[model samples]
Target: MNLFEDLRNKIGKSVAETGQASKRMIELSKLNYKRKEKKREADRIAEEIGWIAFLQWEKEQDIRVNKDLKSGLERLQYIQNEIKLLDVDIEKVKSDKLLYSDNFYPTSNSPSSEPSALLIYLCPYCAHQVGEEDRQCGNCQKRYY
Candidate 1:
């Protein structure tokens, strides 16, 4: 009876360990998938910005012939601003994905026991915790309150 009990205990432990390992593997896989998705999004945004820049350059060439330099310059500036905003967005997405990956697959052997704050940085303008810090708020770009 003792031998049978010990065998059953060992088998149960092994099954539990295997289940934990499988769960960990799935979590790691999810992190990898998220990282890849973020990279793809960044690449797409970069390509879009590149195309916009090229179009603006072409428009500038047209302006020289049509004698509408001012409008062309303005449009170019707008496109540049848009590209900057897109770049910032792409960076933010990438940063978020990395943070998520870190939280999912921590390097430390011991798991964190403390509860993490769900709230991110509060917007200086509107006092909203939007989980990102930037010069302008996504909701309201007001520089000052």
Candidate 2:
């Protein structure tokens, strides 16, 4: 009666939580992939801007007052700003700590070659997921321990 109902509740909660965590991990992986893609794009844009700016300066002997140079500079600044914006968005993703949930296992006496568990880290400031080997939190960009 009451005991059976309580057991059912506990089992239901456990199953639901496991499903939610699995779904969350999939979403987090997708978000991180997109973040890395944006970073790559920003790096490419920066290189292109540097090459254009250097060529313009070399050809014109001055970059302060040329119309075309002014336009190029504006474009470069725009892309740089875009990179900054991308970084901000990535930080926001990192700040969502639920993305970094840990998977753990119960202790077993049977001998096995594979490890039983792994450690998952959270950003100290924003509580976002971080790696044990990471130098800084991706979300807050802060180093903790």
Candidate 3:
């Protein structure tokens, strides 16, 4: 019967969606762990820079020309850049979890054949998910208007 078939299809779709969500969660968790590790490395590099500065000061040496300090600073900058890149990558992964097919396509029972466009807005500061009618970001508490 059509009713039984529809119910079976719905259950199958739900199971598939749950699986996809679990995969996405695992991907996000991995990315977040990487980002946290990068932050920790940044902190370590910062501590190294501080120690370098302290030693240079104790020796009454010119801090600007210190090769060790310079290298540490460079490494810190590189790590910061890496963290920024990871942030972008995390946002990309989050966006991929969106149900684009459901947003764009009409269901089988629908009379209209044309696909509808769904506009998704994100917070500028934190990339938090926001609705089109939202005036403020819920995550960052930043005002859009």
RMSD of each: 23.7, 19.3, 17.1
Candidate 1 weakest lDDT stretch, 10 residues: 62-71
lDDT of 2 by residue, 27-133 (tens): 66776676577567657666765676788789886645456555656665775676577667656655543333343322234533432233446667876656778
- Predictions ranked by TM-score, top down? 3, 2, 1
What lDDT is reached at residue 144 by model 2? 78
- In model 1, what are the clashing residue pairs, if there are any? none
How much lDDT does candidate 1 score? 0.53
lDDT of 2: 0.60
Residue 20 CA error for candidate 1 (Å)?
Answer: 0.3
Q: Write the per-residue lDDT of candidate 3 for residues 23-44, one digit (tens) a residue.
A: 7789999999999999999999
TM-score of predicted model 1? 0.42
Clashing pairs in 3: none
**Would you list the C-alpha lDDT of every candidate in the order shown?**
0.53, 0.60, 0.76
lDDT, ranked from best to worst: 3, 2, 1
TM-score of each: 0.42, 0.47, 0.64
* Over 4 Å off, model 1: 61-145
Candidate 2 regions exceeding 4 Å error are 64-145
Full-model lDDT, candidate 3: 0.76
